[model samples]
Target chain A: MTTDAAVELAGVTKRFGDVVALDRVDLRVPSGVIFGFLGPNGAGKTTTIRLLTGLARPTSGEVRVLGREVTSAGFEVSSRVGYLPDVPAFYEWMTGEEYLAFVASLFGLESSVAKKRAGVLLEAAGLAGVRTRIGGYSRGMKQRLGIAQALMNAPALLVLDEPTSALDPIGRKEVLDMIEALAGKATVFFSTHILSDAERVCDEVAILDRGRVVANASVDEIRSRAGRKVALEVAGDVERVERAVAAAAWCRGVTRVGARIEAAVSDPGSAQRDVPAIVAAAGAGLVRFETVEPTLEDVFVELVERAS
Target chain B: MRGFRPFFLKELREIARTWRIWVLPSIVVVFALTGPVLAKVMPEILRSMSSEQLGGAVISLPEPTWKDAYAQWVKNLTQIVTFALVIMLGGTVASEVRSGTAIMVLTKPVSRPAFVLAKAAANAVLVTATTLLGAAATWAVTLAVFGEAPLRPIVQPTAAWLAWALFLVAVMTLASVLVQSPSGAAGVGIGVYAAISIASLSRWAVEHTPAGLIGAPGALLAGDRPPLSWPLAATALIAAAALAGAAVLFARKEL
Candidate 1:
């Protein structure tokens, strides 16, 4: 295990009777970076998070957090890891302050230290001046409070399972902003099916498909390796422009979308050189021609499709 | 045992905020206060009705004593307080599991055994305290209403009843850990209680199992110096075993 790795799993397999939730999954999340576990629903993302948090034991192989075996060093390792489940529930009677203080007490923090930290975290989560009971808060407020409680101990690794999954757009943005601000403070390992959210804030991502890690790399690496997309708008004879682009050797695939031709190209330089000439020869007026940066969505779809 | 104090404190807080703290204790106290008053008023109530129902025939009977008052209190505890205990603690662990609250807390430094122990300890402390307060109230009322009853008679029976209460709470905690729903937990608890009560009808079971403890209080209040019975030992053993069993099962639970 690398010293800088915050979480490590080696050939970990978790089975519930005849069903295999995670199949021989291997992963390494380095410290001090935001790592995104991207997958569709029922893709075992939550199962993997449970294993890392020591809430569930793997059927086989080793699971480690902070370089310690999770099964044997459960509490010792858990002390350094903060986790938030998908739907976090709190005591409805507890106010935001009371709940955080309760969580801090579990971590054995002194009362004074816990009080100061709770104040800072509440402000960071935008829950300052909210003295109402948790049951009275909206979904967004509860989610924000969930984050504050998870950060009560200032854990070295914060594992959030779909923190923003059920939130509105505004709530999603609020949570994402809070996660983005924790970039250098802790290693965040959050799971999400929303590729755009991962792309917006995650430094590195691992895409899981049907209980296995299909793709794992830095966001930039995946984007660059997924190749580039080029779009062309032709003013005349759009069909002819599409046919020309489809027949071009440099283009991987081409399809006409509305009045434009979109193509996936492995070689951007060659496609840029060859596409315009082909369109012009086909007697079509080229209105717009530009290469588009590949998105995480594109990479995710391609990887999952290939794995299946 | 790590996180015992924090978890226990949280359980206590929950009991205080919710109706469990006041409702169960209030019920017990009300029953205790009414027991002696009911015992004292029975003859007067019957005499008034006898003139009309029996054509002016006077019904004669001996006056009620402190023993009768104590017996009335024990009867209420066995029937009413037992049900209250089961309902109050039925969802102690199951609700937390269903709501995903257990997941959040258990993922921290808290051990599963510590969580179970804290929950059991908190419920035990609450039930024991309230029962004792109710017993004290009964003793004071009986002494004022009836002339000069010794403290030993009331104290002995109250101790016996408290032991049985502790056993019931342990069983309820185990049931909560075993089942997934609050109602299911209560069903198991009440079922086990009924089964034990039925089993106690047999002479062999009365001498061997914890079932004998429930009736011990009533018998003691009637001035029967029943020798230190095997069921008393069995009750204490079963309570400890139930707590240990709960901790073990909770540790293996997936959530």
Candidate 2:
């Protein structure tokens, strides 16, 4: 394990019989950062969460969480970490307070201390003054309570599995706020299929696709790595303009979809300077010309495409 | 052993709040109050009902005694209470796993062994508590109905039956941990119970295994002497082994 890492997975391969869920996956999340694990559905996001939390063992490789091997894992790491599985289920008979109190007890908290923490967390999760049992809670309410219970111990590391995958826009924003507020307080590692949610809160992210880590870097680094796309719409000879733009030394790749030509540039500065001139020489009216900053979604799609 | 205290307390609370609170204890308490009364009046009720059915012919029946009251209580426990225990506890572990509740608890600082042991301990305590209450009720009703109720006779068979009941609890615990569906676990539990009951026909099996205690209760209530120490020890040993097996299996199991 790295000295500063809160989680490290080295060449981890997890297979269920013949089907590989995670293929030689490696990830290192630093301490005190909200690390986003971004992937599409069935992209080994949940499988990695299981391995990192000691809920499942990898087929072959080392998994270290908080400097302890999670395969031989025990309360040593568990005591310091709090985890919320996706769509977390609770004792339907327990109220939000009661569930948090029960979670507090699992951490060996004193009764008085547990009660105090439960009260505070319930308030923060917007569950205060609601004493109804969990069975009657809405999906959004249960999700909030799930986050509250995971925070009962004030753990050093918080792991949430697709915390916002099932929530509405408002609920997702609230959860992202709760997670973002934990910055510098704990190492927050949350997996999500929502790219915007990752871009909104995470300082670093690893994008997984078909059991492989396609990209892992800070949001800005990954965006810059994908570089920039200069997309332009011409009023005439769109295919001819796409060919001319593709043949330019400055344009790495160009695609024509209808009238717009979106080109991947080796250097955004040169492409931004030369795109207009190239379109003018081709005798095309430049209806729209703009340098598009590559989004995390763009990077994800590009990487997953390349990896495939 | 870590986290057993809180988890056991939570289990007890769940038992009190869920359908579990109504199922097993309702059967035990209702039977305790009614079984002995039925035992005392069964002859008269049969005589009246069978007179017309018998076409005016008379039938003979043994006079009822305090032993009959013990027999009544034991009968209800063996037939209804044992089956109820299997069905009630069958989902104790599996339902948690199916509902994803076990993931919430097990992912914490709680060890998997502690989770299994806590559930077993809670069920044991619940069984012991209700059995003791039902026994006291049986004794009181027997005294009121038949006047010569010696406490020793009631105590003896109740203890013997309770040992068997606790063993069933252990078996159901193993079944609950082994099967993922509540109904399937109950089926497995009942199948084991049926197998053991069928094995009780052999004198050697009855004298040496938990199946022995099934009939030992009747013998003790009837003042017939039968060897009990072997079955008692055997049931305890096997119950312990089942519990240990449950804990070990639960530890290795995936969520």
True contacts kept of each: 0.85, 0.90
**lDDT for each residue of candidate 1 in B1-255, tens digit (9 for 90 to 100):** 899999999999898898777888999899889888888898788988888899999898778888778888889888988998888788989989998889989999998999998999999899988988998999888888886667888889888889888998899989999999999999999999899999878877877888778678888887887544688888889999999999999999887
Tell me how far the alpha carbon of residue B67 in candidate 2 is from the true structure, in angstroms, after superposition.
3.3
- Candidate 1 chain B has its poorest 10 consecutive residues by lDDT at B220-229
Candidate 1 overall Cα lDDT vs. reference? 0.89
Q: What local lDDT score does residue B152 receive in model 1, on the 0 to 100 scale?
A: 88
Evaluated at residue A92, the lDDT of candidate 2 is: 90
Model 1's DockQ?
0.82
Cα RMSD to the true fold for all candidates: 2.0, 2.1
Tell me how far the alpha carbon of residue A179 in candidate 2 is from the true structure, in angstroms, after superposition.
0.6
Error of 1 at B173 (Å): 1.7
Q: What does the lDDT read for residue A202 in candidate 2?
A: 94
lDDT of 1 at B163: 84
Per-prediction TM-score: 0.95, 0.94
Residue B151: error of model 2 in Å? 2.1
